[model samples]
Target: MTRILLALLLILGFAAPAAAAGDQGWWNKDWSYRKQVTIDSSPSGINATGVIGRTVVLVRLHSGNFTFTDAMPNGADIRFVDTDNKTPLPFHIEHYDSTVGIATAWVAVPNLNGGEKHSIWLYFGAKTAPVAQDEKGTYDPDYMAVYHFGEGPGTASNDSTANANIAKSAPPGVDDAGIIGRAARFPGQGEVQIAESASLAMPAAAPFSFTAWVKPAQLAGTQAIFARGGLTIGLNAGVLFVSGPGVSLQGKAPVKQGDWNAIAFTTDGKEGHLYVNGLEQATGPAALGAIAGPATLGGAAGQPFTGELDEVRLSKTARPAAMIQAMADAEGKGGKLVTVTETAEKQSSGGGVFFFVLSKLEGVDEIVVGVCLILTAISAFVMYNRFAYFAKCTKGNAAFMRQFRRMDGELVPSAEIPGLDKKEARLIKTSPLAHIYDVGIEEFNRRKARLGNRPLSSQAIESMRAAASEVVVHENHKLDQWMVILTIAISGGPFIGLLGTVMGVMNTFGGVAMAGDVNVNAIAPGIAAALLATISGLFCAIPSLFGYNYLNSQVIPLASDMGIFIDQLLARIAETQAEEAADNAMGGFGDDDMAMMEMDDSF
Candidate 1:
């Protein structure tokens, strides 16, 4: 029994690792750092290196003076894919703040996991939209404006988006060691300013979003990260402060100086929301008015930003919570990864019910189910065998009883029965009723021999009854063989299943502890796997229980038949002896009787 269980568990062990691996193929993952693809405003097609196992690629473009408008720049055609595969990989634009004469562009090239080095073709010209989708068809963000100040020792930084809004520096500018790419640094007096445009201004009632990645050198009186017309996102006294017309709200939490923090502010015409590091820190009711002035970064209204600011984004629409977190997640801040695979979602949404859940079962669960299957097979075999054997015994007993009833209490040799084939004779020899008849006949014959043809004594009749009853006991024992196996199946199946379920739960908690992930995704699979065990246990037990009840019902009647036949045989023997004794006491008178008396006739 132990060995069979071990074999079942072994078969189950392989299932989980394989299923886990198969699940991986449904998603885009293993996002290791790949080669950087370089971009420039000029049409000279440059080459970039690539690596293996990285499905997502980051492209850094260094265009010194040109501005990236909402549309792609003219004479720029940046085309790339795996050279061997020869398909255009999906791409998205990531935004960063600008510095003088030195701007940066971030493009994500996804699904490039092939190991072979691929040739990338690049030329600046008419281009398609930077929007791209994961395998699930969810679109990656396409920023309207992106400025990355990565150019070393340059006077003017370029705008990355097609919208031509470049920043010009007043004095000493770029800082090389930035939080991400190089950042534009400002002294108390220097400022980087973009000329006024309709894109730079926000509507009075329209939804708006603003986000910035900043590392503050000083958090004293007030320092503006970005200030435009009426809206300003700044730091004062170690706390983020957002101020607009009739709206002045400070973040509930404080941040330490020199640490990178993501701060955001969003307003949807009726309410304003503030965030620190991807978490909403404050909210208030409001309607923000439009801003008329040009946008200023690093320093605004004479209060200059002292430290590094890397990525800053301003959109005309308020972003959802998931998108807000995605922005932070893209830059390696606190947020969940957006899954590329839609397989799990598709399975759940399609509504196949229980079979779908069964497919998702874990290793221990599969093992428990297998054991239950074995038990079920054994139970079915036992029930079928018992039913067939009992039916045969019942038919044979009926046939023998029919022949015995027709005999009219006449004792005859077995060979004298008419038309009996060898097969029929063999069946009678093995039948329970026939065995009882043979036992009674043998006992009577032995007593008759001992008493010398006299009427049998009362003590001898009692002894024959005891001998016949003993044969019935032996037949009852034969009927009970292998019934205990059915009992074990009924009782033991559920307990084994419970053990598997408990082990599965333990494994689930252990995995959660090791990974430090306690979300629904982490918890659900384990719990589902655990419950499969109980399902299997019930599968094994229910059929066995029913089968045992049915078979036992048949056995009881056969036992009763044996007892009834024994009693009738003993009574007939007693009655025959009494009649013979009465006749002898009366004295014989007829000739045939006188001849029979001389020959010593007996019962």
Candidate 2:
């Protein structure tokens, strides 16, 4: 038993250190809550590969994915940090409408390796947090112009980069229900134009990439989506086409009409590539001379596109195919590139496993668990008290029995016992056998005084026996005191716990029925909380059961000792009376009679 206990203690000691070591401490003490966001770029997810350094990825938050109430209104408290939990990342919120539970933010990851996984942190729940939006910092220097089309209907789209390449013309039309947010609408005649600038100038055969989410209203002949000097990206019969200074490339497969598709065109100075929905659809050798002109979206003139466009980005360096694919997978609707978990809070001074579990419990479940805890405490107290009482009784009885056996047929007064000492006397005071012997001796003296110089009759001895038996019964009562409390704890603790579990489960199912959603994610927490009640019940009952059995076993032996002591005490009193009677009979004759008897013996 000792070895088993030491082994368990060692295991617990090691486990605590391991748990503490795994915890990367909270990012900020003031922020109360955070969520872990995992960006999976493996084959099972986005499946992009290459050195995709300092990439900006979009993070979408909605009611299904985030708990809006825990965040401050307008989302000023929102902060993004790296997996190290110390380095703060650059991010900007494009849109946040807490009332409707929808928001969008862009975060620049320092490094995103292809075919691997990375993680970041989202911290919130602070009341006095400063706004940390860094629009230009969220994007790298390669991005020349990026437009989200989130401006008001009559306002020109604002560029998100440091170049300040704002649209020169306001969009002629606007669609509120665009892909990510509101989008710029085109009606085959109007266009969004950006004037020529130093940032927009393209040198001869320079590498560049352009991408936009487009939803075509019409797939008519050769409609332009973007065009500049010697460069045009248009659609004919819903198929993608890109034209440069020396080459023209067209995709064989047509994009689905009226559905949002990611259209991209890239030129590495000598070759051109066209992608639709993140997949490479067409490629060809394409070269470009100095292209310096104002850019037009929806068409240069009569070739205007009759469609809506959102999230148009222009990069000076030709982005890798994998980077483009990752962007498409992350920003599109129902994309699985990012996964966010439930919010976790920083542990306070009073926080531990018990408090954490209590946070998950509802009101009634709390009461149930509280009651179970009280019962457990009570049972523990009873067990300790009873165990101590039993130990004292056992020790005292053993000591008194030793002294009684050394009496050698004599019933001596307790104080006059030959080997008695302060410690032994104190022990014998608690002994039930000692008390019964005292009672028997008192009864023997009373009967002997009432019948002076006469032997005690069998009836007299039986009377003294009855008196000792009465004292034995009283001692047994003392031994059995407070034992019922242990029995109650053993039998009732589990049933109480079971009651709590039943109620918790009923409430959980009722909540699920009212919510009208049947997914595992929605119901798992409730079920786990319900099961905690049952676990608590078992915790209360099992220990009580063991304690009651052990204490009961100890009480039985003490009661048996009391009964045996009473029997020995009555038999000793009867034998002493018979010996006294024999002595009196031998002393009946005087000295003359003794001398006459001696002469007769000689004859």
Candidate 3:
């Protein structure tokens, strides 16, 4: 015991290096420096040289610039060295940013740290240049960090920008990202600080402000970042908190996903401001008392952020948009390049609003709908006209039969426009009175030969005389072509109307289902469909049915009359034939020569 006590006393007396020496700074990060750095330069950048650390080293600077502007790189940074390969690191590199005119890049440093030093490089998109370049040689890569922002591909959020219900958990298309849903996100990953709540707590809430370079995936969550009953960002339901209360002065400044935006939400408990890329997107009206909520890194109480968020920052004072962008720019420096996925797109944070705005796009959708309607209407009109045309043709045919039957001229031309055989036409040309003959002259000759001038006064003459007793046959066939359209009118009109009604009813039912209740709103659409279709059907059918019967009635009587007229003409001609024969015989008829000749024809 005495030996132990003596040893303890000696050790206490000797004193030891402060055990908490390495745990005092920010993140107590792996770094080498005496105390801390204090940087303040005008129109010039700040840097930290002689500082040592393992592997990846970060040089943070707070600039008053906006989105990486209002400042330039100066000579205060430590020079990286490739102690092994005797080569530079900036040999193969690229840089990126979204400034007006800035461009910077980096190369690989295969010499130092197994090429860790020159893996990536970055800079502002414009005006960002390498710290220095060897005029005689390529960039040295001894001091480079692998940049991994905007390196991947971009994606699309919507195909036509008109989807009201965008799909979630889908492949984000190029140049677009995010979808519409409740708390929807994309490429989702993060650790839960606290399961029930964002179960993480800030060690000290003394002076805390939050900022992140992000591209929102969606604007559908009730809250983007909500803790307890307080702090929340994003389009929280219909509310937004730049950096203050959960519900203060709500504005309508929404952010689009898939684009690079440096957002900062800083509060001094009294005044809070929301900055985007070094400019204010909006301002908070609620004076924050203490951000009395547990610190949330990337999402609501329990939901992880669903989009790409880079360069997370938390400070005691509010960061200007410019400063945040500078941090991003600095990250894009020669090494350890920081980047936002200008190419990557998360889900949208505002799908409904976006579409709502788009729906209001002037004359776009309306014009499309109008064109569709015009096409439909034209189709309907053509169908209706066709139906009417069928009736008109049928009626006109009947009228032609009546007019022809009443004429005194011989019924030489039949309504059945006979297909003329060239041979028949030639034979008709040989017969002078071809107009009066239904049969070709060859046919007439053939018939006469069978009788052979033998006896016009015999049974053959009786046969002809019997037929002349009637004109119209009253036994016609082959008359159905013009009836089809009328039949269609009778049957199709009602069904077409019914179809419209059915579709309208279906629409109404759908509306009811969507609204979760049956009401007048739901019923109106169905009724409209029903009424319109029914009306259209009636429009099609009525005339068709009427014209069908009218044409048939007019045609039947006229056709019968035409048959009677033909019968009367045949009978009269036969009687006159006998008389003419008698007269000729009385005038100069004899027995031998003339009689023989006459006999030949008569037989």
Sort by TM-score, best first: 2, 1, 3
The alpha-carbon deviation from the true structure for residue 328 of candidate 1, after best TM-score superposition, in angstroms, is 6.1
Q: Which ten residues in a row have the lowest lDDT in candidate 3?
A: 175-184
Question: Tens digit of lDDT per residue, candidate 2, span 479-523?
Answer: 777767667766776787678778877776665443222334334
- Candidate 2 colliding pairs, count: 0
Cα RMSD for candidate 3? Answer: 27.1
Instruction: List the candidates ranked by lDDT, beginning with the highest.
Output: 2, 1, 3
lDDT of model 1, residue 130: 40
True-vs-predicted CA distance for residue 313, candidate 2, Å: 0.3
The per-candidate count of clashes, in order, stands at: 26, 0, 75
Each model's RMSD to truth, in Å? 16.9, 11.2, 27.1
For candidate 3, lDDT tens digit of each residue in 1-603?
Answer: 222221221221332223232323222121121112112112233222221122222232211011132224332121222332123333221222323212232222232211122222122222333354321133121211111222233321211111111212222222221110011133544321222222123222333356555566665654354233355655443234543333254444665555545556665545566655544555654455444343343455445455654434344444333344444333332212222111111121222222221122122222322332333334345445544543453454344434334534223333332444564444433321222223222232344458442224456544553443221221232233335656665676667656655655555455334322233322443344344445445555665567666656745654554445444444434454455556666667666867788889998
Among all windows of 10 consecutive residues in model 1, the one with the lowest summed lDDT is: 339-348
CA lDDT of each candidate? Answer: 0.59, 0.77, 0.36
Q: Any idea what lDDT model 1 has? A: 0.59
